[model samples]
Target chain A: MRYAAIEQWSRQQSVLHRRDARAKIGALLAFLIAVSTTAPASRIAFAGYALLLAAAIAAARLPFPALVRRAALVLPVAAGFALVLWFSDERARAVALLEKSFLSAVATLLLVATTPMPELLRALEILHLPRLLVLVIHFLYRYLFVISGQARRMRLAASSRGRLQFRSAAGALAVLFARSWERASGIYRAMLARGFSGQFPALAPPRWRAADAAFFIAAVLASVAVRVAL
Target chain B: MPVIRVRGLRYRYPDGAQALDGVDFDLEPGECVAVLGANGSGKTTFVLHLNGLLEGEGSIEICGLGLKKQNLAQIRSKIGLVFQDSDEQLFMPTLLEDVAFGPMNLGMPREQAVARAQKALELVGMGALLHKAPYHLSSGEKRRAAIAGVLAMEPEILVLDEPTTSLDPPGQRELADLLRALPQAKLLVTHDVFFARALASRAVFFDRGRIAAEGTVEEIVARFNWTQR
Candidate 1:
């Protein structure tokens, strides 16, 4: 329940934090799309994408080691699939797939590390994303920590009562899920009563300044240059 | 004049268990009434009715407005309900946003909503913690912020469920003081006998889905027959 990992990553402030969250989200998504669209054999293009993601991460001033640790979490499963391709004769295809996944992960990590979850959701809403989808994501983010807190408390209580076992853990998890769902329903009613219409109000509006426009232009030109050069 | 009125109110859960049965109650403007009851005594259910958060059989009115299907928005605007669990009530990321929610929903302009939020925060003495996340606050702070959120609505009636349920001695004292300072009709559902003693001018005992006793503070406290019920 302690989503301290995410909370900790988002507490950092820098130039990256100052930039409009909508721009960051859009750019990172675009980065992912560009990287994924390119063939794995486009070694220079993949390298360029990785460098761009790295620059963004550095600009955010997040701890590199922590970011790397988080980004590395996908390796175990991804490595499993990469091994199959590794044994195949299509080395270029294997490289492309691996590169695509890596760049995509980096883009996501950089985005999340720089922009807080709430702000990111606000950015999505501002970008004219579907209200229902935004609401779903917002609730998930908000309750993830709360439910986790309840689960942790339940586990602690179980341990204190000498009922700590894998079976007991599973049972506690189920109980926590049920209680959290009830809590969620109550919260939903509370929200409805409070006049929570479809959209979450942003703390501050995002301004698409001249610098943001420049950033967008640079991102687009770089993406195009990579595709054509490769 | 009565800000809230309930007569012959009956509510049964979908599972066929009656939560409130033929209960009659009235709350006047600016009067604090503490509802005393044990678990499953229908105290919570009654407060839920005050805000029209739940549906029941028979008549219930808020600020002289009947809680019919179409009157929900107006009833909600006139009555602010603070749930027992602060986590549930304070869902917004920051205290300011959460407090501003009600006013904004009432169609107030952004500047007015924000000003009201700031004032409510000050009323609860939580003005400094406007930007803080609810999850980051202490239990007392969170509770105060939750109440502030309700207060920001500028409702004529404030319904608080267990206002001091999980607080330490100092926190309980602060809560009592805070409740005393607020100038609004308050319907408090709680087991804090001492807090009720300090804040309520009248008391009602709910037992087995009915109002078992209702009278002045001294009248109800001395007649502690509810312990047997």
Candidate 2:
């Protein structure tokens, strides 16, 4: 459901959403690299990176509170590593680890929140990402909705009949897996019936305009400036 | 001329169950044929062979082109097979992209493909839902979108498997009307007798992987007691 909400957000019209996926992807990469490479002692650089991401989220018109909450999901995982660093007596590194990972997650979320999945995947394909990897991501995203629906239905059926015990839950999971396998095969056959060879036919590839170039260059330069100066 | 021709088609599952045995069939251009049978009687398998989706020991020709590895892309473009599960067929991020998929595959320009997709969606009465995700659609809307996805390809023949499975009466009626308006040769595999009578002039019954009988829709339905009592 969270992904569904994000998917809907991606379709909304906005200045950031109108930019080509390539520019957003490039900007995301610059932001992540800048956030990750900044020194633990330079708290000002971290603040600068966070400010840039906040500006992007605002420009994209996403709900600030919700986006911030979702980005915090990375904090728990990062805190595990941060705790280790703290016990090992690396106090500054512990705090910086949480800051860097959270910022990276927020920056990555901005890219997905603005660009539709299809366009983002197309951008990855154009950047020479392996075709197989792109295909996997495409199918995974598409089928996640279906598989989750099946799980939800099974849960409802179980609840209607009686409480779901562990044994029954395990059985339901097995059935879900089998059903998903059958569904996947059916989808593959449908794809073949529609003339899908190994690769999806590229929809009209988006043309890279001068504006897209300008956006990418500005993003990269700004990220580099903050990393080097702040 | 026959838009589809098949001869000596035989297929066996990996478990050795014979799904089709020497099945021969044909679809004259602009003819609508209903394939009627009980579950697992080879109706779906026969349709699958038409587009080279399932390779069986048989020969299939679509619009005068032989069904082979080299001719498969062309043959598929000529025969649009809509699966029973609309959920499986509509996999693109949005309805528009899913509908445009076939045209884009055939190497049509993006603008042309999008235009064709939009036209097809309009034909199916889903013009306004182009940006909607497939999961968000009602069952009937999903079915219409799936049909639009195939129609966008402009196939000469349309093959639908168990099309009325999840549809209510109104959805079935709407689909029947849409199918009636299409000019392409149609091969419908369904158990819905009233639906068949509404659209199909002729009918073929499959029993145990072979064509048990073929005749006018009334004759086939009566001979097999196919209608709901």
The model with the greatest lDDT is 2
Candidate 1 C-alpha lDDT tens digits along B125-194: 9989887777888888889998988889888888899989778899999888898888989988888777
Worst 10 residues of 2 chain B by lDDT: B130-139
CA deviation > 4 Å runs, candidate 1:
A1-3, A76-89, A196-203, A219-230, B225-229
Candidate 2 at A179: error in angstroms? 1.9
Global lDDT scores for all candidate models: 0.82, 0.91
User: Candidate 1 on A95-213: residue-level lDDT in tens?
Assistant: 67766776787778877777777678778888889988987887887888788888888878887899698987788778998999998998988887776665566555657787776
Listed per model, the TM-scores of chain A against the true chain A are 0.85, 0.93
Superposition error at A130 for model 2 (Å): 3.6
> DockQ of each candidate's interface versus the true one?
0.57, 0.63
Worst ten in a row by lDDT for model 1 chain B: B220-229
| lDDT (C-alpha) at residue A131 in model 2 | 91
Q: Quote the positional error of residue B72 for candidate 2 in Å.
A: 2.0
Q: What is the interface RMSD of each candidate, in Å?
A: 2.1, 2.0
